[model samples]
Target: MTIRVVLTDDQPLVRAALQMVITDTADIEVVGEAEDGAEAVRLTAELAPDVVVMDLRMPGMDGIEATGLITAGTGATRVVVLTTFDDDDYVYGALHAGASGFLVKDMALDDILAAIRIVAAGDALIAPAVTRRLIKEFTRPVVSPPRWSELDGITAREREVLTLVGRGLSNTEIAGELSISIATAKTYLTRLLAKLNARDRVQLVILAYEAGLVATSQ
Candidate 1:
């Protein structure tokens, strides 16, 4: 199935580059382009593309707000935040705003395409470099207390899975770490998602951090 995509970036060069690469892919196609967040939202509503590649900063609205609006307003279309800035604020903001994927501009174009595909398939992704920083950032003591209630209904095994996920381990790695099969790892992940009401893996990572399942030294 073809995955329709909308490119939302203020830089024409970035959009053009992405479009050029995406057009070469048989499964993915660029359906629309937006220079700002508002236009992105409008285009998303009109085009109903499978995914939107959003930029963090724009003249109006901004990617975070647009991401929230797109995800909240439509169940079919997902947002992938692609930006030059990997600042902690932008990372947390985009994830909190319902972005299905978070990537930095410095990543290879092919990886970006893969991320779009992953998100279009109803999964979530975050760049490896960004994920490491995200873990470290969350390790710092916060002014507010951790939300332990979020993990109330989850089992101990599910909490283990969430901790591995927060550490950016893949399913295979999680399975290996826990002496389980890959399918079992996936099942635990799925259960965690449902039990925690997480939107995707990214949110699970955030929740794991918020619940203090991930430690600073680890």
Candidate 2:
């Protein structure tokens, strides 16, 4: 199936570059483009693309607000936030606002394409550098553990999976860590999402951090 995408950025060059890279793929297509958050939102509503490559600092609505609107407004559309290292301050907010993942602005074009496909396939991603920073940044706070009843539906093995996910381990890594098959690891993640009412892997990571399952040791 062809994955439809919408590009949103204040820079025309960035949008053009992204369009070129995406359209080069046989299974991906750039369906629309927007120069700001409000336009992104409007185009998303109209195009209903499978994924949206959203810049974090667009004028008017901005990426965080646009991500929230796009994710909430369309059940099938996911947003991948594009940012520079300077935009790290907004990463947490963007994830909270429902971005499926994020990509550094200067990352390899191949990596950016992979991220889009990963999110389009119902998984989440964060650039490795962003992951390291996210761990360091959120680990500064000491949070209380959530109640057992809150996690009553999750099995111990599933809790283990969540912890790995919180640490930014991919499905294959989680499988290797637990001596399970990748398919089994994915199954555990799906169950975790349904049981926790989490939206995606990013939310699972946030929940694990908030509940002190991971990123608590200093």
Clashes of each: 0, 0
Error of 1 at 218 (Å): 5.4
Residue lDDT tens for model 1, 1-218: 99999999999999999999988999999999999999999999999999999998888798989999998993589998876554656657887788887767888999898889999999987544567776676345444688898788888888888888988888888899999999999999889888888889888887777777776666
**Colliding residue pairs in candidate 1:** none
Model 1 scores worst on lDDT over the 10 consecutive residues at 134-143
Off by over 4 Å in 1: 127-130, 137-144, 216-218
Q: Which residue runs of candidate 2 sit more than 4 Å off their true CA positions? A: 126-130, 137-149, 216-218
Return the lDDT, model 2, position 179.
Answer: 100
**CA lDDT, every model vs. true structure:** 0.84, 0.84
